[model samples]
Target: MSKRLKQLTKNADKNFNQMIIGVLIVAIGIFLWADKNYFFWPPQLRLLMNSEWSDIVFICLGICLLFTALTGNRSRKFQSILLILASAAVAMLLAEQVWHVLGAHKVEMIMAVILDAGLLTLLIRCAYKN
Candidate 1:
């Protein structure tokens, strides 16, 4: 690729990463605000809040995996796969809590599962591309 094209692609990727980080920060902020303002939490979230050692360890592991996936000097395919798995784990954990809070019905559960599977497949395919 030409130098100018390469530079543009790099800048685009950097901007996209920044956007992802910004969105994640905003989502966390909203979650914290809601937690503080709301009187009740779902049992699952309450359990997490109660700070069981296992839950804390699991959360730390997930965060570490995410950090490594983002910042490690690994092959693109490897990093992409790691990123996808880490993201899915985190997303599912949060989604489960939300589902509990919402008292999710069967249809909702099925939809979520289908969506997650489809997303996973797409990410895997993208990661494998040259």
Candidate 2:
């Protein structure tokens, strides 16, 4: 096999491993949040409208933005992550403040799920692509 192909193969493996580590770190952090509160710290489906969730969502959005800015080759991955973060921020804001079965909160919730799923898919793709 060509040297370039071998180098690429090795690099791809390293990227795959990094992605696995990233997934595990995120999963563990989320699990820790759940353990602490019996749910995510931000508390989805807020009926009382806690401002704390908004803060957490904002932080997540910021992190997504930072990742997108830092990783140019992983634009696809971070683009989806950014969408998810945006949806999360909107959903948390609406769910906590709006509080209705068929209100803005519902749309936020739907967008959150769609974007999150897309983000996961992008991450998976990026993991394999190197």
Candidate 3:
């Protein structure tokens, strides 16, 4: 690529990264605001409002994976591993939260399982494709 084209690509990537960071910050702010105000939210949503240690860790890992994918700095295999690990962490987190809300309901439990399985499959496929 020409020097000008390369410079443009770099600037575009930097802008994209900044945009992603800005969006994440706004999202977190919204989440915190909602958590403080929405006391009467459903049980499932209430569970999300109160994040545990594992949830924070998984969320951080997901952010790291997102940056890695955006920067394209890691090898494909390494990125794939990160993606899989992040996906599993997310699945586990969701399952744990859902369990707290719907564990007693057999039908909900089955639905959660199906949803989790579908999510995991979709994440894995995207990981491998990239």
Over the stretch 4-94, how does candidate 3's per-residue lDDT look in tens digits?
6776566447445333432343343345444543222355566554555444554465566555645553477766676667566647645
TM-score of candidate 1 to 2 decimals: 0.37
Cα lDDT tens digits for candidate 1, 1-130: 6976776555446434423432443343344444442223454566455344434434443443344434432466655555565455545545654564466343434554555455445444534541
lDDT of each: 0.46, 0.45, 0.53
Sort order, lDDT high to low? 3, 1, 2
Task: Candidate 3: list runs displaced more than 4 Å.
Answer: 1-51, 97-102, 106-118
Clashing pairs in 3: none
lDDT of 2 by residue, 99-123 (tens): 3324444444455455445544654
The ten-residue window of minimal lDDT in model 3 covers 17-26
In terms of lDDT, the poorest run of 10 residues in model 2 is: 32-41
Per-prediction TM-score to the true structure, in the order listed: 0.37, 0.31, 0.48
* Model 2 alpha-carbon miss at residue 86, Å: 2.2
Best by lDDT: 3
lDDT of 3 at 9: 65
What are the per-model numbers of colliding residue pairs? Answer: 0, 0, 0
> How accurate locally is residue 80 in candidate 1, as Cα lDDT from 0 to 100?
58
